[model samples]
Target: MIVASVPRTWFEEAVVVFFDVVRGTRAEAGQVLLPDGRALPGVRLVEGEHLAPGAVYEAEDEDGRRQDPERLRIVERRAGSDPAVRLEHVLGDEGTVTVVEGALQGIERPVAAQLRGSVRGLGRWGSLRRVHGEARVGLRAWWEAAAGRHVSGTPFEARLEHRLAEATVWAVPRPHGAGRWKVRLELSLRGRSFLRPVAAVALLLFRNRLREAFTDRVDRLAQVWNEIVLDTVSQDKSRLRERILDAAASPPEEPLL
Candidate 1:
């Protein structure tokens, strides 16, 4: 409900056309020609329309910019009123970040999402490799936007189901005024039985500072997301698919504008 003028119809329309946009990511006929006519290699849909569960894509890291390439599989896809997709960062036999899960749900529009993921081997320190306390968290995040005089928002309870040194996160946009909104991010920490004391101590020492840093980061990300939305909307509506495919095929940090 971020966009003030968007009603349930717009939300439905978005949902209907969303897959078309997603399918644009597929390297049609095994190649993606950039808008400037540069051919992007090493990326293609191996199965399905690249949206079906189990569809595979062989692509280079960073869309061929990185020398190392990886095969990504569409591990899961849910289609309907509440839809979501999950991709595996395939690394040989085991999926390092395999247990990750998230969903977008709302009666009319997307209002909240949740994730229970791991970060145990993220640091890759050999000594600390055995310290495997996975991070399982659920977060509800929100997005806000302004279209006219009022800012639109979604309400979420901010409940976090957590079992780690940290908690799950969620967001609900609370409107402040036109083109402005306030996002309140709440984090709770409840460690496993063995690490409760350490978790408590860490929270006591760094909670406030972490919150400030996270809030600043979220604000910056919100700006980037909104900019992309505005930029996408400002273009010719018929070129939506081209724009999406172009953007996806391009290397990171390069904007179509």
Candidate 2:
């Protein structure tokens, strides 16, 4: 089973704003937050690609050549201003599209785990179930912390309110085995307009030091959350892992059958 989630139109627009800001940063340095609530060195928005707010990518094939069809288009703007960074992406099906705005792309980990964990839990009943359950709950809590609550006051303060996102779960089912699954997770943002507050906060708190500080903040957030995910998967049952390998070795039959 594959469990996927994405935002609507405004979400896409918000993403555009984010990229625009990042581009701005390229032209000049700006303020950004650190995990310790202190400001870090500033930086210029350098580069970006098909990764926008509310989007994820996976190496579908062995060589990792195949990518998700819903490729995210990226752009950067507003690097010199206080909230001097913006990033954007276009999401959803061809016609009915939506925009998501946030500092940058960050929400693939948990999505992968959720997809795999759900399938694994169905086949076996033990630690995997617990791990997935804890992850699911944690994701919700993180969402509330970053996305659900609105940080009011100044525009910068408001945007800063929801810069980070909860973890997402991902899963890849073995085409050949019902009981086999591969699970992975990462922290990701859900809210569409969260970038506004994040940019706002950077301007207020970091002032002109937003560039390097923002990059540092994003890096630290990923490192900490990645550690959490790695620790959780440490105790993964060998049997389940074996099952996943077996399924991978023997893929599903062709549709012609």
Highest lDDT against the true fold, candidate: 1
Instruction: Please state the error at residue 81 of candidate 2 in Å.
Output: 6.8
lDDT of each: 0.50, 0.30
Tens digits of per-residue lDDT, candidate 1, 1-257, equal: 23222233444445445555553343456454444445555555656654688777665444434333345667888876666666665443332333345566643555545443433333344223322222211112233322222333333433333344435454444565654455555555567667898877877898889778876777787777677656655566666556656655556553111
TM-scores for the candidates? 0.59, 0.19
Number of backbone collisions per candidate, in order? 6, 72
List where candidate 2 sits over 4 angstroms from the true fold. 1-62, 80-86, 91-96, 102-257
**Relative to the unseen true structure, what is the C-alpha lDDT of residue 255 in candidate 1, on a scale of 0 to 100?**
19
- Least accurate 10 contiguous residues by lDDT in model 2: 111-120
